[model samples]
Target: MTTATRTLQLKAAPLIVEAEKEKKPVKVRITAYTGGIMTVPGWGPVIIDLQGLDLPQRVTLLLDHEGRTEATIGWGIPKTDGKTLVIDGTVTEATDAGKLVIALLKDDVPLQASVGVETNQYRPLKPGDTITVNGQTITVESDTFLIEGGILREVSVVPLGADKQTMVTLAAGVRNMTHQPAPPENSSPGETIEAKYILDLLSVCGDDMSTFRQAIENRLPLETAKALAETRRRPVIPPVLNAEVKDTPASILAAAALKLLGKESLAEKELGAETLSAAASYKPRTALDLCGMACQMSLGYAPRGTNEIIRAAFSTTDLPVALGVAANKIALDAYQQAPATWKSFARIVSAKDFKEHTGIRLTGDFKLEELAAHGEIRHANVGEETITYKVTTYAKMLMLDRQHIINDDIAILDQIPTIFGRAAARKVADLVYTVLLSNPGGFFSAAHSNLITGAESGLSVASLAEAIAALRKQTDADGLPLDLVPRVLLVPPELEATARQVLNSVELYRSGGDQLPAGNPFAGLNIALEVEPRLSNTYFPGNSTAAWYLLCGPADGSFLVAFLNGQQGPTIEPVDPGADKLGTGWRCYIDIGAAAADWRCAVKASGA
Candidate 1:
């Protein structure tokens, strides 16, 4: 006769159980392999047995959901006399036969699961053994187990969280329920998050959320926000509490709350409104335009009528920096407009390209000698000399009243920079001119360089001709004739008429001569007469009203004027606003030095 098959249905309850509360059971479908375990949601697993039911019968089993238990099966029908068969146990110790000595606890009695040599392949277990049976955790507390015929006997068992002592002992190996919870959605693992990313997240909450989110997000510190909010006159309603509000994005919630309290956004407010408008309207053209755009953006913010605020915002712009730029432009214009007076007669050299200082070497002149036929040539050592000069910086400061900036009169503000620039130009011209005229010894004193022989009589055709002859006859350090020709006749304003008459005349008259038939010795001379006021200025030491110079070509290096290479003219810069007494004044300066490098290139005559 064929035995009919039976169906055994299995189900698991939630791991946490309250006897009085009802919970829906999770159905467990058994597959062909009964060894596979099934788990309950928010719970552990359960093992089922489907082979024991009688044919055409339905059986339901209720399993312990929260307490400790071992894997087992009942050998008889429900509610009938039957023996319970235990299959799992806690390992107590290893036996000499290489088996795990196990014990089962049932009604406080001991049963053993050791099979001696037959269980030799099983790993030897130690006291405090941990093992899982049908999702229930079990621990072995003793090394000894009462065993009968290789079966598991009584063993001590404890629930995982039944007591504080058990939790403390198991916490090292497992994550205890008291450990910190996992990160929430939209949260990261770092201590801080990017502001932009936070802003983006707030945007996702909704446009209206901006008011609330901006309150907290715009504030630097929570205390500051609180203080600002406390000062507001109007009472703000606290946000409504609900599921959606509770779940609102963190950034949006923060900003919205701040908006409600009427706390200003520091970042937005600090950037002035004018700057923001400028930035929005600005279109970048060159690389400089890009810089301009950045300046506008940096200064852009809420509008405040205070001059300090407006100036502070503008301080971040290129305008203040442009002050120095304007100064430089002014200096350049001044240098370009340099008078056609002294510079035309003096050699000008740039000093800026020099790293620390510049030097002018005056080499001794070389002399030519007739060479002997096939004989060794004699070498003459003309020692070299050097004159070193360094650049000096000059500066001036100007101030603008705080009230002027407040008025926002750009026209008034503009004039100061231009004035500063023009001032720098004037300073440069004055410096170069002073250096050229201040030293009379470079021209009139023979002891200076032998460029002058002795004090000549008053300015006249004969006196001028004598001075030119002296310059032509002068020799260099090598005792060779310099072949110098006087090109410019430098004089004071008092002698202009005499210089013009002497140079323009076609003939000369001698007061003591009886009769002389000859052409004018001063005629057809291409000498440019330059009248400089500083020549007779009493400020310059040793300058005489009648002192005059017959100067050679500038290329001849009779006098040298050096300027810092790229900075051939004065430069303008803003005084450090913090250090300046004049809050709005800028400084203009020039770096320059001048000296007569070689006096032999000109002849000086102390006129009577």
Candidate 2:
């Protein structure tokens, strides 16, 4: 018996099963153990000796290394075949788990095979050592080892296997049936093929277990499953047709945009090519043009001029939603395109509500301890701290009146929102920088052990070294070294050239007394330099172009910018302008808040 476990990858052939036969147990043959260099968790890399391979006559097959009886779905007989170990097994279709395995196999779902072996004879090999085994030369890189013998204790079917080369080959399903049934009809061939395709897609995107199970139970349509899978892969807020837009007018506008963007294929597929073709006939030029189109669709007649179109659009119930959709698209594009440097180094989270949210900062997990024979196991304590912040709304309104529509001043709808969108992005940047520049209660001072000042602290190789050292010296709540690495260098526009020189230059020479050339330590460090003009803007308090910061990546949890409901960007919605106001007004706002979460992940160099 062996104590050490090694995972090996092996190649497998596709599962082949006939549809005409009665359902029975699935026969499987797999290359259990492929002799080669494998990296074992906790033990590093090791090579199992095939000639010294030890195993029982049969071993139970489990699921993902679970030791319970319910996990044991089958058993296999193992035998040595050259450098590999092969296993022939039958997975019974009696149990639910067993039935699932068979069904997945029949649907062409790929399941990897892993074996849990215990190594009894093994020894660590020295670095740079070379040995010949299984007709291949192996070199020791780190903590490499050689296992002389091991027992193939158990086999398991897993979602992901350490070995990529090994695979479970399912045998052609032919059962010893007692009786034969009448042949099935082929009347529903189309539906059968569609169902099969959908099932295959479901298996491929089976990572979302709940969605996968739901799709399987309901036997969802191919398009619906595809949409769900695609949405699961990468979630994005579309420019239109999102949750906010539900009315017919908004849908029409969304469809029109989709048609204009040449993404008509999906729309055409879902809503006939004829419908899209008709929409293509009427191309809306301006806000007034869209209003006129909406009026015609809802009122059965197009308004005469821009004023009438705007009035008609404003009068309709769902017409504003359509106008809002177009405005939102413009604003969203601009907001995304605008620069927001804080995103580079600050963690952004979604706040569930406006109430004060408590964020738990777990310094680190408890270390694993050894247990003595019959000794009581003690629980280790974890280090944690709480930080609280709440999201608040910030907004302003832009009016789309009759004047702009009559004059056809497109900037009122286009460039105005574009400017506001960029401003919304800038607003977030301002809030994040304010936390540092304000330096409330000396947050970045010597007391915090993060601030470096004086003329010598200016942006340079030497100064950056000091800042990097400060950040790396940060410790967790447990008083252990965090070993935080600085990933971004934040500077004002005035120090952009200096920051680039320190980061990009291959070598440097010290000024004054020492003129000796030295290799730039910051070069090739992959530290990004982000220059924010607002940091030195006179409009802000404590404005200093000389101030620069070295910050860890966002994952380090140094600083945080939270959004209400995880909406990172601004939200634009249509607002009633009242009687005095002629046209529709749009309110652009963002629900967000920023605060210092962890002081250890950033070091400020006051370049005064």
Candidate 3:
């Protein structure tokens, strides 16, 4: 390759190096060795050689490989120099007269500078050509050019060096550059250097090979590790069956399985097998026999049979007992929490479990005897009267599909108990309200002589007081005063406001503008005012919205609401597998009823 050289002469002016505190440029000649690969600091590999020859040893070398020009510095390298050069200039005029008029920047302040141009062929300077002076580069920033006074070019220029200074400022504004040690040549990206070093150190410190082998062997497979963890988490339970038997019933097997599955009490091996056998087949297999056969088959100890398969098919899948218990709990909780609207007013009596409840109310009193003057005494005939109430069971069944159990969708199943419970409570309230409104016992009829009729008269103080007096005047079969006191005034929603007014007012107002001085004789009466929504609209033919009642105290038992003794609320029962038509369902039921016990305890006023 042929090598060429060109010399570029810079202005022989004082070049002050601010970083080195030097005042003047140094004279030096640099001889470049060409046509060879050389590595530059900022520029990558290039086909150029730089060799020989400079002046002061302190001067730094800078090369513009593309321009093929070497600029020598007297104090420091341009790359390393901390001082920045800013060229802000405008070329006002350029001429063939070898002079140019321009505006230049000194210390960031704009000033005028005259630059001389040397050309042999009288080449005129233009507005847009880039130029450098004293190592400061500038760009023609504006298109405006003016020629005056022998000047050929006039333009605005911005210093390019300012761009470099800006770049440095931006880089400094970002995160600090920290020098990180180079990674090992053979190591992967994620490999820990400290760990490798520690291992090496350990190997050098100890010569025990057995420990190293043990450490390697200690690493377990993922599956093995998981299995070990699972084993540790499982609770240990003692075996319920000590010896294996040849013929085990399906129920016994189920019970044993349940015990193993963490439900010991509900296992009920004997009872469960017997119930299932009685329901499923005439010759039923015992739970123990079926389960034992299954176990044996798993161990190759016995052959599989149709009966075993059937038993497995009916298996609870470890959820029956748990679900049953949970359902019972949910039902009981829902029952207790359900709103007791009418039940709150009626008297509740418990009935024997699975049996009818009887509420007895005595209507007649003992006969009073009169004294006799003769030797013989006179005796009055005694009479006994009784009213009986009985409650019957109301049942509902909910079915679960096989898919639900298989998918473990038990949350929906939990709602069954609560739904059943709330339904039972609502039934009880409806029954009580129905009884009161229907007055089936003639409690509100004229036969009972408690119904007061007058269409023109609405609920007024006089009318209510009359009703109360009539109730108090009621007598038993012995012709004695019932001694009854009105405890509550039951009214329809339409009459609730009128009832409160009549009971709460401190003074009574007459239709003729007359007022009673005893400021509301009903004040401090403490009589409970009850508004029954069911009574607002007509339920039965005579059930009137304008009707109201004066009832005896709750302790007097004018009305009786009865429930099964032990089964007061609601009960949830898991259906036996064989007997279950749907195969997956439970029964929820309640035994409750309500009736009017004694007509003497209350009186009704049919409001007009």
* Predicted structure with the largest lDDT when compared to the true one: 2
- Which numbered prediction scores highest in TM-score against the true structure? 2
What's the lDDT for residue 300 in model 2?
A: 36
Identify the superior model by TM-score, candidate 1 or candidate 2: 2
lDDT of 3 by residue, 298-395 (tens): 21122244333323333322123323444555676678798765543467777654344455545454555565677576554555455566777777
Q: For all candidates, what are the clash counts?
A: 29, 9, 23
lDDT of 1 by residue, 232-316 (tens): 2112111111011111111122222222223225212322333223333444332223223322222222123343343433332
Q: Which stretches of candidate 3 lie over 4 Å from their true place?
A: 1-318, 350-380, 402-409, 506-513, 537-542, 577-583
- lDDT ranking, best first: 2, 3, 1
Model 2 residue runs over 4 Å out of place are 1-241, 244-247, 254-278, 285-288, 303-309, 375-377, 510-517
Candidate no. 1 TM-score: 0.46
TM-score of each: 0.46, 0.55, 0.44
User: What is candidate 3's CA lDDT for residue 296?
Assistant: 30
Query: Relative to the true structure, how large is the alpha-carbon lDDT of every model?
Result: 0.40, 0.65, 0.44
Q: For candidate 1, what's the RMSD?
A: 31.8
TM-score of 2: 0.55
